[model samples]
Target: MIINQSIITDIKNIIVQSKEKAIRAVDHQRTLMYWHIGKRIFEEEQEGKERADYGTYLIKLLSEQLQPEFGSGFSPRQLERYRQFYRVFPIASALRTQLSWTQYKLLLSVDNEEQRDFYIAETIKNNWTSRQLERQIYSNLYERLLVSNDKENVLSVAKNEKFPSDAKEIIKDPMYLEFLGLKRETSYYEKDLENAIITHLQEFLLELGNGFSFVARQKRIHIEGDEFFADLVFYNRLLQCFVIIEIKTHKLTHQDIGQLQMYVNYYDRMEKLPHETPTIGILLCADKNDAVVKFTLPENQKQIIASQYKLYLPTEQQLLEEVNKELESFEEK
Candidate 1:
């Protein structure tokens, strides 16, 4: 009997897709079930509010009963987490089916509503996994952004409430490169850092900003007397511009800014389409003095930006101080 191999392939694909959908459906239903449990427990606790230790008692008793019937999935700690989830997202409509319970648990850990909302928006927008959400939260991406930009604007851009008008709205200062797996003690050349970024390109893009697509690395440029190679070339679709990055392993100098500005000019003059915006240049350095960056660029500078790169994630106290210093630096201008 003649049998078509294509049919077998099609059937296998169909089965795989169906199973995937079924798994997602089951996960979503489980999330809803958890929300329902939380809501019901909260209602009961509210009803017994006048009683001493009523909320605690209600949760403990419910956990005890649920554990035997449903097994340890309903442990007191888990039940408490579920309750907290419902509390955070009281409006049932606010629950996103796309997010799994694990992602929701991460969101529940975020105390600030604005920060939580930003994470939710980013997670859904970026289709981030629970692990990605955890990394952003632990790295203090929200607070780091707030250091340079207004909270409402940051959230607005993240939520797609408004399109970003300025590069500052999207680009981060002191972008974290810890994911590149470079040690703090180790000194690296520009070529080494560029290679590391290329190897970890996905994570680097995520850290860079929105809508970044890598164009090239070590992209050669021609000039009358000299040739130059841009460390990284990227296109930002949202901004509709070319972004040229130059890596500096040391603190930025005026000459570095000048070099980046030259790259920006060349890209804008030669490479950019007339309909596209001007090319934006970024000097990614290990350390930078804002004063040097400020004075080195033109007064109406919008295209060239000097950003610092950190090898390691900052501790809570260190993050606080960095944010404060950045805020003060901004205010000074």
Candidate 2:
């Protein structure tokens, strides 16, 4: 029997599409299974309100009984995780199937309800992978947003209380590139770091937070006779604008701000769609002096922002220092 070539190609496409959907279905079912298991465990452990001691003992006993049969995923620590998971995602029906266990795990670690909800919405909106979700949460995307935008604006964005017309809504103060594993002490060229980020672009985008779609690497632009290249170009669907990122391997400077401003202007004037909002510029640098940045930029500067980057995660003491500093600033305000 002779098979028609066109029919054969169509059959192959159908098979491929079917397989993809089947895999997604399997993943969804598996996630639901885990959630239901967590729910069961949580309900069984809840003796009464204000019964932490009793709950702890119950988890220990439950783990001991379940561990041998269920293996490592059912250990005492994991049981506690399950309980916390249930608490974080109380409504099983509302839990997104697209999100993996790792994403859920990362989300459960976050204590801020508004921030958590923001991430959840962004995750679903962006279809972020688990690794991506972990990186954003680790980078303290919410805190970065708070520092970058007005307090009222930031909180409103987090709660989805209001939507902005521009990319400014989601632009963070500091774009964390810790996943690149670059040394803090060793000096490197901006291009070198930019190349590395390009190589690990997926991880970098995830760290950059939600709604970021890579548009170009070393995106070129010509002004009069001079040539300039943006370190990275991305489109944020949530914010609805082109994001021009200028990567600096060294300390941020006024020149960096000037370059980014020029790029933002070019995109806004020459490239932006009639319906699209203005382009947002970000200067991602190794180190930043907040006072210097404040003085360097014009007062009432709305578009350009300089953010400090860190290679490693902050320690508990560092986090405490940040909190205390923010509190002090709040008091002064």
Candidate 3:
């Protein structure tokens, strides 16, 4: 009798899948246990009307009693977090089974309810790991998108209630590329930056926002024997269009904007199908002047945009100041 190697491989795959499913089931049960513990504690505190005066004492006493019997996981600090978890969620039916306790713990740290809800929906949609969720929150993904777009509309997208109609809706101003491990002061060629982004493509895509898939890098174009190369090309399924990106290591100028406009026109006329929407060109530069961008494009421009890129994450205070400045500018307009 001849032994089949394919059957052996199939058995291995089945076993691995079974183990994975079992692990997920266990994790879901653990998450439910924590939520129930939080619910019970919250109910007890509310019934006794001791949350304001003796809440800390109650948690401490519970920890002292439970730790020796159960484990250190029942510490006072963890119990406090559980209490906060219940306070934030409140409804048992609203808890997501896909999120583990670790993800919920990180989500609990977000003070804004809308932001927390957005992250929750996005984490499930994107299947983000706990580390990815942490990075997104730390990078202020919600605030960055809200800086340029309407708050309600962006949150709606997060909840899957509405889709992005235009490239601008999904694109963020001053994209944070701190994951590339590049220094802002360093002088590097455009190719070097592009290579780094490619090497860390997963992190780059997260920074690029949702529904973007990589298409090409250094895509060649020829028009009447004049050749050009686009730095990066991506297709956003949500927007249903191709995105052409041009990289500049210095402040943007009218000439750069004109070049990007040509790329957009080229893609629209030559590359885009009749059923497809217009291609969008993005100028990712180290800096940009709003006035320059305003003057370079036509008054009714929609397909071309110039945005600044930062190699490092900005401090929360810096981001707050920038958002405030943008709001003030919008009010003046």
Candidate 4:
């Protein structure tokens, strides 16, 4: 008897599909169980009518009995998390079936309700894994976007209720590039930084916010007898435009903005399709004076942006300071 390769391939695919289905079913059941546990704890605490005085003790006692019988997952810390989860999502129907217990546990750590909602919506929309969700939260993605956009737009975009219509809507200032493993103290050329971004393109795209897809590196364009190269090119699906990025290792200048403007013009005229929106240009530099950028572009400018890039993540306090500074600048304008 001869064994057919096609038969073996079909059998393997069926087994793989079955395994995936089984895993998803188990995960869904586990999430449901945790939610139920959280609901029970909340109800029991409320029934006692002295939850404030005895809630902690009740959780500890429950953990002591449950951990010994069921395993370590029912520890006091986890029970507290479950309680908070129930509080956060009082209605079980609001719980996302796709998310796992670990994902919900991570979401519970976010204190701000609006910010937490944004992360929850984005996590589901992007199909982010637990690790990805954790990384985004730690990098302060919600705060970073809030710095650039009003809270309403930020939440709307995260929820997929509104798409980014302009470059400013999606671009984060002082984009964190710590994932590239570049040291802040080291002196590196623009090429070195560009190389690092290309090496970690996936992470770079993640940091660039949603809808960005890499198009080219050092894309060349011939004009007259001279040739010019764009450092990086990406297309944003939501905005329906080409995003040209020029990396500068030092502070941004009027000249840098002007050069990027030229690149934007080139893309708009030469590369962009008739149906596409105007091309957007970004000057990603180590530092940028908002005043300089404001003065350099025309008052009606909408396509070009200058943003600083940080090799390391800033502390929450630092991020708050930056947001306040941005708000002050906007007020002055």
lDDT to native, each model:
0.89, 0.76, 0.87, 0.88
Tens-digit per-residue lDDT, 49-159, candidate 3: 844767777889999999999998899998888888888988878888888889999998899988998899899989999999998998888877776677788888988
> lDDT tens digits, residues 1-333, model 4?
888899999999999999988887898888878888989998988898654667888899999999999998899998988888788888888877778778888888798999988898888888888988888898888877766678899989888998888788878887889998989999999999999999999889888988889999999989989999999999999999999999999988999999999999988888899899999998999988888998999997889888889899888798888878877776666
- Worst lDDT run of 10 residues, candidate 2, spans 165-174
RMSD of each: 2.1, 3.9, 1.9, 2.0
Candidate 1 RMSD to the correct structure: 2.1
For candidate 4, list the clashing residue pairs, or say none.
none
Cα distance off (Å), candidate 2, residue 226? 4.0
Of the two candidates 2 and 4, the one with more favorable TM-score, higher being better, is 4
- lDDT (tens digit, per residue) of candidate 1 on 1-333: 999999999999999999988887899889998999889888888899999999889889988888999999899998988788788889877788888888888888899999999998999999888888888998888887887689999999999998887787888887989999999999899889998999999899989878899999889999997889898999999899999999999999999999888889899889999889889898999999988887887797799988889999899899889889888987877
- In angstroms, give how far residue 57 of model 3 lies from its true place: 1.0
Higher-lDDT candidate of 1 and 4: 1
Q: lDDT score of model 2?
A: 0.76
Estimated TM-score per prediction? Answer: 0.94, 0.78, 0.94, 0.94
| Residue-wise C-alpha lDDT for candidate 2, range 238-304, written one tens digit per residue | 7778888888877777877877888999999999999877788888888887777778778866667
Clashing pairs in 1: none
Q: What lDDT is reached at residue 162 by model 3?
A: 97
120 Cα displacement, candidate 2 (Å) = 2.1
How far out, in Å, is residue 259 in model 4? 1.1
Lowest lDDT 10-mer window, candidate 1?
139-148
